[model samples]
Target chain A: MQREVMFAGFGGQGILLIGNILAHTAMEEGYEVAWVPSYGPEMRGGTAYCLVVISDRPIGSPIIRNPMHLVAMNHPSLEKFAPMVKPNGVVVINSSLIHIGSDRDDVDELLVPANDIANDLGSIKVANIVALGAFVARSKIVDFEVLRKCVQEQFSSKEKLIPINMAALEEGKKVAQIK
Target chain B: MGKILMKGNEAIGEAAIRAGCLNYFAYPITPQSEVAEYLSRRMPEVGGVFLQAESEIAVGNMLFGAAGCGARVFTTSSSPGISLMSEAISYISSAQLPVVFVNIVRGGPGLGGILPSQADYFQATKGGGHGDYRLLVMAPASIQEAVEMVMTAFPLAEKYRNPVMILGDGLIGQMMEPVEFPEHLRTEPSNKDDWATNGMDTRKSSKPNLVKTLFLNAEKLEEHNVILKAKYDRMKREEVRYEPYNTDTDYQALIVSFGTMSRVCRTVIDDLKAEGFETAMIRPQTLFPFPEEPIKQAALKESCKVIISIELNMGQMVEDVERSVQGGRPVHWYGKAGGDVPTPEEIIDVIKSFVS
Candidate 1:
């Protein structure tokens, strides 16, 4: 029951936030989880990424060279990681921003219009939350309620942003289920 | 007592706080700068002193100043910066000062890249500075172990009245994992009047206590070295730590690695086991006062054919491996310098070539 996921995008696209939310939710669900982000000088607008590992048992190695899932939020991420997805794995792409699709037929590919869905919800910044919603809905790695709780916990101090983010998650989840 | 996801450098800083290290002096270095940044925030909350010194050399001297005042102190740096601190470290050792220094190693003969490398094994285990002394060195493979080792290092340094080190690499410093903090216990410095230069009082004593490494007499220096050697010999007997993986089986090869590099070796061992290759690893948790007896015995066994020492440096630990094996088995070395970490598959490939 070991699962590895990589969320990659430009620096301001909230790739790290998405991965951290997933890791936090997994940890809350009583699973072994680790979230590792890119460090050093390359973290500024130059392909920021994070690796999240969730397992039922203790993890052997934290470094994930081959991931079970990849969530690409932009064209560069899709171009960089789509081919590296394991056979019979899942690749969720933000179709609103990523124009390219995977050529491999061995894996499952989901193209969700994350930005369009977030814009419809009245905020373009919630696209990352939408992509996260889509991943949780399709993969079922963590419960949606637990993820929501984690989101609240992360943004608890900022009471003004909580309702909008929760609404964004629900909207994303609904769109994922319909698509 | 619960797990919290933390980076290695951040974990060490927190552990030092938990271990009752109230005074921290350090300069920023890449791959280890998080330690200082974390302490800068955390120490204030805990009523501790966290000073960002002028440089690594100044930081080491600051540690000396704090230790002289009977305060538990710590500092962290990378390769080049550690080289700058070596002189102070040697002085601290000779002065028998209790302090902890962490070296989050980066690759180098000189100003190398800001990636992980184990090239400082020799510099750490052997005498890095001009002296006949050894600092108790602990290597951590995971964030949890990093926390525990740091917590233990304070007591060990105090117990031995000498400096201790937490030697890690850039990968360990940067990597994130879950860590459990130790039971909350406050550590207070004991026996301050014994050697501390805390402002003298007339009622206490008439003599002044000076902490200095200078022994003008040749015979006294030899005697000091002998005493230091005895302490090191006792540490070798008591403090050798290692983890044995798959040692029960008739292994075709034995892999020796330590610090963050050992995690990659563990992955390689698992991969080779899936492919029907019998391999084992001897991971040294303590680099200095190394677990040599176990390695020597393992080398003498007929079941273990080849010993491979894997590191991020060219061949620093390889020399120690050769010494431990005592020429009974042919010791091989594999490494990638300048902050390059070898992949698990690359390690497996190197091991497969040795299979006779």
Candidate 2:
């Protein structure tokens, strides 16, 4: 099975970072993955996005026009990409930033207050990881434990911030389970 | 080795190092500046040289200077920057230096969008620079293939003593994929003492090796052109590489595409197969040699009626497709320019129109 995941937000929201984490997690699980970021002349606060594609077999095209799922961190990202998601795919909306839902009922829409969760964990920088945790927990695209390992490995060089980020991930996963 | 995710540009840099090419001189340009960015940090760790030149012109000349000293050297640039390096490319080719150039192509006649486009098909396969010279050009569809091609390009360039280009689109540069760099492809420049100006003392040779392109006399220049022509002809004979997809099927149309454009067409072919419209594609890995014979043979199949050249540009490769077909099949063109790559659905529609 092949799946495409889009993660989008204002630039510097770590949209591409979360997307990369997801792609790396998929790779760790023995899936072929491609992470394509919207690049060049992109400015801070402007719309920055990335597409992560995972497949059992080799991926033919990484430039996917319509992804199966979306983790939209802002309103524009949700509004623009929600309509393109395939039926029955998960659409994660950052409820902290985006107030509205996916509008269409064909897909499973989970609203997680990712920023608030990260804020409670003491920093807003981990918000992207929180959203990623919520998306992975809701979709089960990959095993959660593997994701945990990947996230820790991502910040292995930093060392001190892993516990807070892990807390933020847990909070996000909790919201996904409840909602 | 375990698989690790890498952007194509960064992967290209590492691949070059793996191929024993340690000298990199380049002027950064989108969407390929990441190659320089990655190499700048990684090179020092490997005890390699990485210099950001003042401009692409200087970068090209730097490559010439390094390669003449028998160093495996390369540079990466986008469209306009490549154009700036064209003159140097011609000079280097005439001097018969083994050098690698990568054009992670952005759209344009002049500073076009910073998105993927294969508009440089003519610039690459044909002569982008001037005079009688051709770069041995290869187009890779995936990140793994990009690594392999970059590794292989060094040896091929050294073998032919000519400039080789890794022609990728912006998507190939920007996209990140899991790549396992091959262990066996690493190679140092061979037979460098034969022609390289790497000090007669270093080689303990009596013959003074002078690398120059200034053949001002008519007969000498004509003789030099003949030698270059023979090298290109030899490459065409020995180095043509392509992948034929679903050619065994009784397909009615043949799709000739390369780079990321070929990836989209691969999906289109699969989807069409599901929908009961059989189509075949020949993805050209070597654009310089053009895979002319293969296209001709594929087009001559009894079931194939039309040969379509799908590119990201406004029909640049289509000309080569038509020439390859040689009037045996009706060759058609489908494409978009300056990025906005044609979707699989769009390509499917185009093929359906071609067949139906």
Candidate 3:
């Protein structure tokens, strides 16, 4: 079986970073993985996106036109990629930045206030992690314990920052649990 | 260590180190600048030299100088930068030195946008430089394969005393994937000391070695060209590499593709099989020493009716495919050339149309 996740947002939203984390998690789980980024001239504040492909078999193409899931951190990303997600796929919207819904009932759409959740836990930078937590909790594409360990390893160098990030993750997971 | 997740660009940098290549002279260009970004710091820590040359021209000449001195050297660039280095490439080939050049190709006729492209197929497999010379070119589809190729390239270059290029598209350079480097089994060419200008004291013989591309006499130049032709012919006889997919099954159509484009074709083949359509593919691992015989035989399969050459370029590799098939099968070409890779769905549609 194979599943792909497209993470889209404006640059500086750590869209690529979270995609890296997911790919890393999948690798740790012994799944074949590939992370493809749309690397254009945009370094900051411009559109940034990445796709992570996880598979039980060797991955053939890292490029995907219709991904299995999407984590849209901004409204433009939502409008651009939401419709392209496959049926029964989970669409996670960062409700903190995007006020509108995906308006599609064919799939599971989880509205997550990631930035707000991160801010309540002390920093808005962990907002991507919050969205990641929500996505993983809903899709179960990866084990939550494995993801938690992956997140811990991601911030292992910065020991003090791990708690707030952990708190943001839990808060996001809580949102996925609702409705 | 176990497998580490790394970007293709950085993995290539480390692969060079593992292969015992010490000198890296390069100019940065996108979708591949990360190699320089990676090696800049890592090289010093490993006691290797990493020089950011003023231009691709300087980088190429620097490779010539270092490789002449018997040091393993390499440089990475996208399309236009490679063009700047082409002059030096030809000179190095004429001088008969071992060096490695990597082209993480971006779309181009000139200064094209920085995105994945295979348009450099002709520029690489054919001589980009103005000479009767060819680079031993290997195109890698995945980061792991890229690392293996980079490591193998040094030995291959040294063995033939010719430039070897690791040709990858922008995606191979920009994407991140897991890689475990093969053990360093690369040994210095047994004959490098015989011709390299490493200094009289370092050589068994006392004569000073000279490295020059200029053979002013026409007869001498003709002899040089003949020797180069012999080496290329030897390469064709020995180094052709290709992977045939789904050919075990009776298939109606065959595809000839390389690099990133081949991976997309593989997906199309798999999807078509589920719908009960049988197709086969020949994924060329070596662009030079083009797998003419394998493709020729695959096209003659009783079940195969049409042959296709799919690429990211408009139709560069198609010529090679047609020449290989020799009109035994109807060869078709399908591609796009504006930095946009054709999707698997689009390819499937094309393949279905071809089959019918």
Which docking class does model 3 fall in?
A: high
lDDT of 2 by residue, A48-137 (tens): 999999999988878887899999999999999999999999999999999999998899999999888888888999999899999999
* Residue lDDT tens for model 3, A1-179: 99999999989999998999999999999999999998977756878999999999989988899999999999999999999999999999999999998888988999999888888888889999999999999999899889889889999999998888788778888899999
Compose the digit string of candidate 3's lDDT tens values, residues B270-304.
99899999999999999998999999999999999
Residue B195 CA error for candidate 1 (Å)? 2.3
Position B173, candidate 3: lDDT = 96
Give the runs in model 3 whose Cα sits over 4 Å from its true position. B185-190
Query: Where's the lowest-lDDT run of ten residues in candidate 1 chain B?
Result: B184-193
How many angstroms is residue B298 displaced in model 3 relative to the true structure, after the best TM-score fit? 0.2
- DockQ of each candidate's interface versus the true one? 0.51, 0.79, 0.83
Give candidate 2 misplaced runs (Cα > 4 Å): B184-188
Give a tens-digit lDDT track for model 2, residues B1-356. Answer: 98999999999999999888889999988899899999999999988999999999999888888898889999999999999999999999999999999999998989889989999989998888988899999999999999999998998999999999999988999999999987764555878998899898889999999999998899998999999999999999999999999999999999999999999999899998998989999999999888999999999999998999999989988898888989998899999996788889989989889877
Whole-structure CA lDDT of model 2 = 0.92
Clashing pairs in 1: none
Question: Candidate 1 lDDT, tens digit per residue, B1-356?
Answer: 67777888999999999988888888999989999999999999989998988888898889888898888889989989989999998999998888999999987888877888887888888979888889899999888888999998988888777889888987789877777897776576666677778767822877788898888899998988898888898899989999998887788899999987888888788888888888998999988888888999877777888999998888989888898998999899998896657778788889988876
TM-score for candidate 1, residues paired by index: 0.95
What TM-score is obtained for chain B in each of the predicted models? 0.96, 0.98, 0.98
